[model samples]
Target chain A: MKRVEGLTHSYRFSWFALILAALGSGVLLLIVAPLAALVLSTSFGELSQAAADAQVIQSIRLTLSAALTATLISTVAGIPLSYVLARKEFFGKTALLAIIDLPIIIPHSAAGIALLTVIGRRSLLGSVTGGLMGSAAGIAVAMAFVSVPFLINAARAGFLAVPERLEKVGRSLGASPWRVFFTVSLPMAWRDIVSGMILMWARGISEFGAVIIIAYHPMTTPVMVFQRFNDYGLAYARSVAVLLIIICVAIFVVVRFLARPTQEAQDA
Target chain B: MLELRSLSKQLGLFTIADLNLRLNHGEYFVLLGPSGVGKTVLIEMVAGFITPDAGRILCEGQDITNSPPEARDFAVVYQDYALFPHLAVAANIAYGLRARGVQSKQAAARVRALAEKLNIAALLNRRVGGLSGGEQQRVALARALAPRPRLLLLDEPLAAVDIGLRARLRHELRCIHQQTGTTFLHVTHDPDDALYLADRVGVMLEGSIRQVATPQELFRAPSDAAVAEFLGMRNIMTVDSASEGVCQVGRVEIHAALADESTSYVWIKPEEILLSRQPFDSSARNQFRCVVAGWENSGPLLAVRISSGDLTLTALVTYESFSELGIDAGTELYCTFKSSAVHCF
Candidate 1:
């Protein structure tokens, strides 16, 4: 058998592999135990009851739809930003990238407060949006605020991986700039863009601190889980959490299966 | 027909200054240079990707220096053969047609015709990402020709293809040019490519066109030292003395009725130097005794490096000649050549 890079071989298995396996299992258990325990703690009866609750169903629908909305809006706006960031060189590019990442680095509650200051009822933007507080739009704004960086970064990487020569070839083939973007750049980078959208959507659906502060009344699934935990204790929250995990996992798997390999990945 | 007049660009650390070149209709004009000579910048400038700071571009007698790439109506094949990974071969070829508002059926027909001409018809339905380097090159060529632009620019198109396939592709490119009758401006570093494909060959160095001529003229009569060296001439000698129609070069006196005066650089092509075992009568003006200091196999020929006293020169000898003369290192030989073969600049 051939030896892989970064792996040292002995009789059958390498010492590096053996140690990695042993050490990785500990971290794996630390993450998987909590999720497994949550699922195990919830009975089928409790899960069905939680699923049947009107507030639970409403929050689930609200969460998925808000996430979808935020992802769609980000896809439309973030793709251009990512494409420019990937292809253009300008003063303050690094600073712009850092600013895009500010929401992720800052505490989620702090991020929510920042959004409120911009789009709250008393502000100019709040009036323009008919006041964002406690509205579905507020929830989306909060979700987008915390999740857009993931989309931008992923899409930027995708665009960067695409050879600039391809775009030039398109131009030389008599394609207008906009036409080239739509026909060549977008399709070539779609796999990464789709992956980015999925990541943003997943992150948005799970958002709690930001969404709760912006729109607590119209609770998303995560916010509802928190409400259930605060009002009825751990048991109700655990069941809701288990159900949400199953839904998110199913969607994630389906999306991943549908995505074709990117050009860079295929070349590698 | 295309012309670039006094074009200039200052791209950090490199500059292309006052570069001028012209292409006749249906001509294969090759800009041959070593890598990093800013050949790409010149091509991009003509393609309208890089606007020249100080010159005008003319195509078919129209001044189009400020036109965008799409409006320029010129196609290009990049070095990497940048086929669209998202599209199949047919779709990639059809892209230019679709962009120009050609009907779908017409575009498909054009795509199929180009694919067949490029011998890529069987691979038309396959995704471009899965193609080999040569196949991708053909797909890119097909795409560039699908629109039938007035001129085509190829930037080191064979630079990424397999070496073994290059000679055959070179022949195919010449055939394609004849069949299409489109003007082509191909940039490459390979002298063989220029000699084989160009109707006119231009040597570029340091961001400027050093010389341009028909392949035969350029090979036999390079206008400058750079052009001569670029054309693979290695027997460059300095003048030690001068007379009415004679100049002392290396250890031998050269008699040339056509030699230029007021010249410091003298060059002779390596293949032009004749190697003989004994002094023979010939009309050649320069003949001298030299010892073979070293030899290297160059396909069917051997590149022999010889030195007479302080002067060293390289000469090409066929394997048969090398064997018949029993030539090896330290062997004495007589090298003869017409001094008219010496190009002065």
Candidate 2:
């Protein structure tokens, strides 16, 4: 019976099946190889030149600053909203959650257009704010609008994972509502919120379509990458892309490693 | 002193209505009941976690019905210990003090003192999540007690601990209460917690306090049939009064004290009933010939179910007596208990 089973399984692995599997894997490798080649081929001097470009520098700085600012805003505002969503029950709560997550499913350019309609000079908020249509604030708002749902959802899951009993105990210990949030809930949900922030920040930094429509002049890193590829050739674009990738990868690796150790220790 | 006057709350399907309780200062009061009896809800109301919809919670003479938990000056220890996972033992203990605007040094000092008292000094720097069940419980207790709240509420604090650790924790809790003179309103379903730790016990059922009495009184004499059954009274038998001192169960007339002048339900603890293989003479006024309907082992005790005519009674006996009497289903035996043991309600 064992021999027959092995023979039948072996027979299923035809040459065509093997070839298909190899081809699939090879395609993925091929897609990733340009990124690898960019990293390998670019020297420090080329990276410096790319970094020295006035537009490139401005875009990189703008991207980091906007992404960081958006992340901070989300962290401050999103954590409480997430906690409320996780812990409270009220009418329209499910609908509210769905609305918060709507941007992730829609097209980025469409999201940008929708944002433009709401915050453009012709719109009510834009008129109230005296023309915030194509400024840095508009870009930040647009990036934040599209990326904030990830943070809120992740933070909500984190808050949900924390037992309600902990907060009750904190209250019973004479800690006020605010104290309990800081002392128990926030700390317990910190890792999830942090990871969520990282994702949101990354999302904000890479945003192209929405940001381009809203504030094309500000030129976030992804928009800059697109522009470089258009104005120059693949080599210059790849060099800048390579620099961005290296910086992001280094940051991602360090943070992930630090978080990984703590998670494992906590699990143990 | 803490008082809950007609305290009521509605949570979806469960409602605690018209619950009135009073806990004197420095008293250890245990609210005992079955699960879902709303004992925890009552305690939570007093602790200021849940507001009573139609009641007044008075601390000393002050009405604190609408007070937030921070303003209530009451601390609670939950069954799960609810220790802050991110805070160190010391930090958790200090949290209450810090929240109430205590100076950092004072909070630290208080934490140190509390840690020492709770015997968690060595664990002061360790995160609460790293501690064992007993250690976490101590930290929770320390945190709750450090603030010196007017009333201390413990909602089955030892319920989640292993059985082996329960007795020790209960003892430590009692000791802590004694040392602090803190008014403790403890909620528990376990009879042992009531018996061991409470100065007084309130037996609750269906969101109401059925009977509130001393632990001994609760065990020896419950206020009603429901209270008796709740306190593990098993030897209940219906009887017709023949005279002032005599009651008839089937064909047998047993002498029992006619304390209450009404048609009453009789309750006796299973352990109070004595089993004999043959007719034996004793001070117990009530004695009847019964057939052993069945027998089962309950931990170290043998639970013998006996039937006298149509009346059935349960008796808890030693394992040795069970074997020596050769007690089994269909064994004929005499069951007797003291007249004083019969509680009529």
Per-residue lDDT, model 1, residue B262, is 65
Tens digit per residue, CA lDDT, model 2, B1-345: 887899888976668889888888899999999998887778777777787889898988899998887788888888887777676778888888988889999999988988888888999988766678889888888888898988888888988988999999999999999999999989999999999999999999888888999999888677777787787777765655545666665676656676344535676778999999888778898888899999888888988899887678889999889889998889899998888787665
Fnat, model 1, is: 0.77
Give the interface RMSD of candidate 1.
2.1
Docking class of 1: medium
| Candidate 2 local lDDT, residue A211 | 92
Worst lDDT run of 10 residues, candidate 2 chain A, spans A259-268
lDDT scores of the candidates, listed in order: 0.88, 0.84
Q: Second chain of candidate 1: TM-score?
A: 0.80
Give TM-scores for every candidate, taking all chains together and pairing residue i with residue i. Answer: 0.87, 0.84
Every model's DockQ: 0.54, 0.46
List, residue by residue over A105-210, the lDDT tens digit for candidate 2: 9999999999999899989998899756668888888889889999999999999989988788777666778888887888788888888988898888888888
Error of 1 at B226 (Å): 1.9
Candidate 1, B156-268: lDDT as tens digits? 98887777889877888899999999999999999999999999999999889999999999886677767778777787777776665677776577765555566556777
